[model samples]
Target: MSWWGKVAGGAFGFMLGGPLGALLGAVLGHSLDKGMKGMEGAEELGPGDRERVQTAFFTTVFSVMGRIAKADGQVSKDEIALAETVMREMDLNVEMRNTAINLFNQGKADDFPLDEVLDQFRRECHRRNTLIQMFIEIQIQAAYADGRMDGAEEQSLLHICRRLGVPEFAFRRLEKMIRAERHYAGAGRGRAAPPPSKPTLNDAYAILNVNADATDAEVKKAYRRLMSQHHPDKLVAKGLPEEMMKMATQKTHEIRQAYEQVKSARGI
Candidate 1:
């Protein structure tokens, strides 16, 4: 079973026993019985700390995504569609899909405890900066799903970055990269005409979080650091859920493309 299936099937309450636990109980309903027996021995052996981090990442991601969706006062059809698209992309099974939708709905509630959830997530991450950055990146992707980040959504993103100890400058840089990514992706689909000019040159630098004027050595250093930070094996060892590895993989692809673009442009 996938980690999410195990999470929903296992007696999460026995291990989590916190707001996240309560939330899972409400979301999973009576579906927990299917895998209960399998969990019995594992529970006696004690929950894996990695399991806790995985659960935390899964729970916090969907809930926080819903919160961001509602930041503009009303969740638009586009936003709803975006959520469904993400579910499809993740290839969630029926049970896990329902649970994810419930988590998203819970996040839209007026009483949703954003701060508490973030605090718990931060604790679970245990200062693993790469995981935290990936978390922020996913949130940013959700915010930009509608093709633009509205004022309310931008404010919510900034608030999230502040709470997560992510610098504002870094947040802005990621925002630019996401926008660039969307544009780049869109331009390649069934279009006979090309954009007046490719933005990849500038976007490449943004993706590496470097300046156009940076030296070749500086660019090389930035590329290596980003690649190291996003290495899937390293992140998985540090407790990134298996389901999220795809996103990390995609990130590395983007970084590599960006680096290649920069290297070509500079003849390096």
Candidate 2:
């Protein structure tokens, strides 16, 4: 059975015991454990469990996303649409989609345990740095869903980064990359797509996180590194769900466009 099967069937509950399990159990409308609801100490999860990690990834992502959306004290229509768009892109089935929606709503609650969830999530995927980065990227994209990062939203994101051990500098680069993706897709300024030149040389540079002055070799190196990190095959092997291949491919596609633009500009 797939990880989702195990998770949805509640077969994976024990290994995910703690807030994550409790969260999933809650959204699934089944009690994983009476004790799980108030459980903390997700620190006990180790990095060696691949099935466990995959289960945790799907569970934490939607829930934390809700937390971020509510950071500004309200969830916008666009923000809700953005979450739905992700669900569509992933091609989730009816049951899975409903669970994801419940998780998102769960995240918006007043007493959501953001820190405990992050701590456990970090540990579950400790060996998969790229996987963790992918999760952060999703959150950043959501924060930018309405085409602007609200002040409270930024603060919420930064706190997420700190809890996940992501540095401020790294967060800055990830933000630029997500913005570049919007430009590459001709998403003029918001979720609404508008036709434009689509990713000027400057946006291309931002996508790759390199400046125009960088050596051609450096540019190529960055491209290769990003492609390798975001590659769907590699990510799946590292514990990402196969359902996420479309999302991962989009990321690599954007990077490729950025790299080609940079190369073309330099006459490489």
Estimate every model's Cα lDDT from 0 to 1: 0.76, 0.83
Q: Write the per-residue lDDT of candidate 1 for residues 45-140, one digit (tens) a residue.
A: 333377777788888888999999999999876667667766765667797788789999999999998988887777778888888888888788
Kindly report which residue pairs in candidate 2 clash with one another: none
Find the number of clashing residue pairs for candidate 2.
Answer: 0
The number of the candidate with the highest lDDT is 2
Tell me the tens digit of each residue's lDDT in model 2 across 194-243.
Answer: 34456789999998889989999999998999999999999988888778
The ten-residue window of minimal lDDT in model 2 covers 188-197
Model 2 regions more than 4 Å off: 34-46, 188-197
Worst 10 residues of 1 by lDDT: 187-196
